[model samples]
Target: MKIEHLTVQGCNEWNEDALILNERERIYGVLDGATSLSSAVGVETGGYLASRIAKEVFETSELPAGCAPLRSLVLMANERIRTAMLERGVDVNDKNALWAAGIVVVRIGEHQIEYAQTGDCMLVAVYKDGTVRTVTHDQVDHFDEKSRLLWERYSKEGLPPDEVRSRVYETIKQNRLKTNTSEGYAILNGEPELEHYVEHGGLNRIQLSSLLVLTDGLFLPRKSGEPTPSMSDMVALIDEKGLSGYVDWLIANEYDESQQGKYTRLKVADDKTAIRIYFE
Candidate 1:
């Protein structure tokens, strides 16, 4: 298998998304840090610190010889974050002190592929016939319909970035109460117990021609009234153009300042990371 990957920071001053691809070890992963609620609670941005911990833990950990190592990796990463927070005198009980993450991990084997995901990061497999199958779904989508509607409304209101961010933040904060619970979404947040919430699966290697792992930042832009491209359309675009080319088109066509108001998005831009692997 040949691999290509990239990570681009969003419009923000920092990029919270992180990627780890070790083709020699047949390991690929991505983590998106949640935006910080308050910088005063921690030594650095929660998202940045959490992502760094995840990457470090992943890089140093040994490869899994069993079902999958994602659960263990997330568990260790969470412990590292908690230890760091405690060392900095940050209150472990405070939600603001703990960083949360949406993560995806993939391990490619000679005949099979194993994967695990939590939160919104995605893994897509494209078969030789061009059929695309999603290996994991967005945990956020499991939110109540009312919450989803409210978010969509806020996204389309054309509010200032700060105002929009505040609204979104509050909503997420409220939602955090349910995190790792039966009613809430699953994310890595310094809690090893949350491992059970992760989604895992396996795929036959011979049936797949390529695989793509991406964060939500790479989604198609949605217009106020018009429908956005379907997943098939996105896969087609990537097939026609290379991964970089598709990303270039997305930024040029939708994210540029000149294109504002033409499309409605949760954020002006988001930290984008993607890994494309092709099996020969």
Candidate 2:
């Protein structure tokens, strides 16, 4: 299998987004640092740490088939983060925590793949037959009674379905109804924890035409009303425009310094990066 990848920082002056690729093991990953909620007592250091740790695991481990190493990687990353803080004399119980949103997919060839996701970053598999499918579950913006109610109210107010996610997320966070320890940061105080998803078998005949992975900046649920494109559309776009061209398109269109999307209030307009992997 051959890979094509691209990465860009957020629109903000400070870009804490990081990405890692281990071509030898056919593992590709991205981590986006959540630095926007400084008042919530967390640092962006976790994102970088998580990315490096995950990359190292992929590079070093000889993971067996059907074994998704995401949970292991997250556990390793967490331990490393905690240990580093202790060694640095930083309070382990400090209100400020560190987190990086990311998604990881390992392709074992022959149209077989497994994925692990945390935070809002997403992974999708596009089959040669044009089927678009999401492989990872979101750790944030989950569905609930209140979220559904908010979605209904906001939808009646002319908000698109995708745009409703952020509003619902904020409502849950700000109202303290979602059990978040920190008023503003879900991951702080452990309201949000990492989630792992795996799909095995049923991958035959799909012919991994393309794999699309993206950070929140490139596919903000509320932005452009572009419907964020399906995995099939993402693959089609990549087919039309090589990885470089796709990166250029994203930068040229989404990186306006003055532009703000519906979710801008809740999300930082950071640089957008995406990777497309094409397999034989």
Candidate 3:
């Protein structure tokens, strides 16, 4: 396979995002780490620690000799996160106190592509016929939509960035509480029910032209009333402009003097991570 990848920090002091590429194991993926609102771990934030631990497992750990059980690796990572949290003295039962991340990973085989996803990290496939389809769902889309609307409302009311951030914090907190539950999205957050939320699947390799693995930071900013960004549009943009082209586009328009960034996106910037893979 031919691989082109990118990982970059946004406005945050630490790049809480990470990537996983193990050619020997034929595995590749992306992780979007998010720290708790009040978390401030010593050297690295909880988000960084969580994603970093998962990245290490994917990159250095051994898989079963013949099979690529992607979900097993995720479960291992989740278990490790649970242990790490306790070591750090975080209340595992308190979702708000523990770090979390959305991960999407895949193992490409000669005849099939196996994948596992939790949270909002995405897997998109472009077929030979120029058709594009998302292999996994956007776990955070529902909550993000509500948050985006809140950002739009506050910004439209002429509230400053600081005030808008403050106004939206509560909503973000409430949504954060809903993670790994029936009411909310899926994530690898050291929660007890992670197995139930993990998404895994296989796709015929012959039908695919390429695979794009991405974190939500690569998601295009949409205005309040505009159509939501679709997988087709994302694939189209990558076709016209490479992965780096999309990053350039995001940085160019992410901020302005009047507001933090686009009203649709709640933050000034977010960690960006993505990988493009083409089968041999």
User: What is the Cα-based lDDT of residue 240 in candidate 2?
Assistant: 81
Worst lDDT run of 10 residues, candidate 1, spans 142-151
Better of 2 and 3 by TM-score: 3
Full ranking by TM-score: 3, 1, 2
| Top model number, lDDT | 3
On TM-score, the leading prediction is 3
Q: Which stretches of candidate 3 lie over 4 Å from their true place?
A: 255-262
Task: List where candidate 2 sits over 4 angstroms from the true fold.
Answer: 36-46, 60-68, 92-96, 107-111, 142-205, 220-236, 257-268
User: Which pairs of residues collide in model 3?
Assistant: none
TM-score of each: 0.88, 0.65, 0.94
Model 1, span 190-270: residue lDDT tens: 765676687877888877899999988887776656665566778888878888998888877755678876665656788
lDDT of 2 by residue, 1-280 (tens): 6666666765554455556676655667666654422233234354444455544555565755444455555445545545554554554443344333344445454545655555557777777777777776445544333454566577668988568767777665443332222222222222223222222222443656767777656652344323334545555665687767766665555545566343222334455666777767
